[model samples]
Target: MQNVFSEENIKIISQIDNWQKAVEIACQPLLEEKKITQKYVTNIIKSVKKYGPYMVLTDYFALMHAKPGEGVNQLAMSLLVVKEPIDLEGKKVKIFLILACPDSKSHIKTLKEVAGVLMDQCNFELILKGTKSQIIDLFQKKEMDGGKK
Candidate 1:
């Protein structure tokens, strides 16, 4: 789906180095799309950070096994888990594509229908045997394509 957050929000989220920042960045697009309110987004982020992926599983039945534990790893896992269909300002939001560190192939099967699923092994092998920048550049290109890539 097309990203709803403003470019400034996307930039702010992307520039930050922390997982919290990443979560904020991920949610910004949904907030702007009106698929979720700011309050809901904040709550989702907080819940995921504290309780893990279980936060959205009830709302999104497909996320039955999305619970991650604590800390940055959990936070990253939470972001990777919370995928739901949403309506943004009238448009129906379809997917939430996550790009992780390649080797962390924890939930590839769960995201079969969304879009790209980069397994850590596949990504790591490519980076070591091929070019690391290609993956990063792909993400950049996707972002530039407004999430359609």
Candidate 2:
């Protein structure tokens, strides 16, 4: 099977210790693939760097619901969702960071659905805490599960 996580991509991913780095690295491959332009990537990176990831998600939902900004909002909305990290494990792991918010309750059902989708596609895990070692362990365990299956 082709390795979905290329060395360059891994380098970029590893460098993502903050939201700015995450935006830049996450959008780099897309820019290279011509899936998005440099200007768009810059905009996204700036937005994340300024307001953070949760703000981006909030903007996305606002645009989706209100169709604000003559569709620029909608475009931003789609970009945020599409920019979610690809499943390099060949499986889906819907890791949600729980926060104190009223809407957080709604996310549980959707996150569960995402986990189910991931597992159906391949052996996967749903993590709440975003620890690197724990994420690695999930993939390692999935590999063992695959062997058994």
Candidate 3:
């Protein structure tokens, strides 16, 4: 099986100009890997524009995703850690988690795994300041632990 949590899927950037740019940057890896089509990115942005920053799950994190089959090609997830926070309307978000799951079932597992990590303040801080390898390891560890602590 191809590794879902590879270094290529994680990015650490100094900053982003805007929330839309941040979403594009976060989904770039997945787009290049053909995990999702450009439409998926557009859909997420449009959804946010229409519904506001509902994806901003936490003060520092935003989980960007559209419904399944919008353009998802596979079950994949990517992360973008920005050194400086991007303003999503009024919310400040530095961590962008882009998800491209082909179906409902796969996203649940992915969401659970991500929630496990973010639920812990220590892990969340580590990811905010972590190297790409460190972030990859954190996700791998989460998956290995079956989304447990």
Candidate achieving the largest TM-score? 3
Write the residue-wise lDDT of candidate 2 on 1-149 in tens digits.
01222322222122223343434454455445443455554564454445534332311121111112211211111111222442311322122121111232433443343234334423232222234444444434544454223
Residue 107 lDDT in model 2? Answer: 32
| Per-residue accuracy of model 1 over 9-126 as CA lDDT, tens digit each | 2221113333444445565544454444445445545655566544232221212122232211221221222223443223222222322212345435334312342333453233
Q: Which stretches of model 2 miss by more than 4 angstroms?
A: 1-12, 15-17, 55-149
Preferred candidate (TM-score higher): 1 or 2: 1
List model 3 lDDT by residue over 1-149, tens digit each: 13457888889999879989988988999999898999999999998989998899888899889888879999888889999999997899999999888988877756776777888999999989989988888878877776677
For residue 33, what is the lDDT in candidate 3?
88
Give all candidates' CA lDDT scores: 0.34, 0.31, 0.86
Give each model's clash number: 2, 0, 0
In candidate 1, list every pair of residues with a backbone clash. 102-120, 103-120
Highest lDDT scorer: 3
TM per prediction: 0.33, 0.32, 0.93
Runs in model 3 lying further than 4 Å from the true structure: 1-3
TM-score of 1: 0.33
Look at candidate 3 and tell me the lDDT of residue 10.
Answer: 88
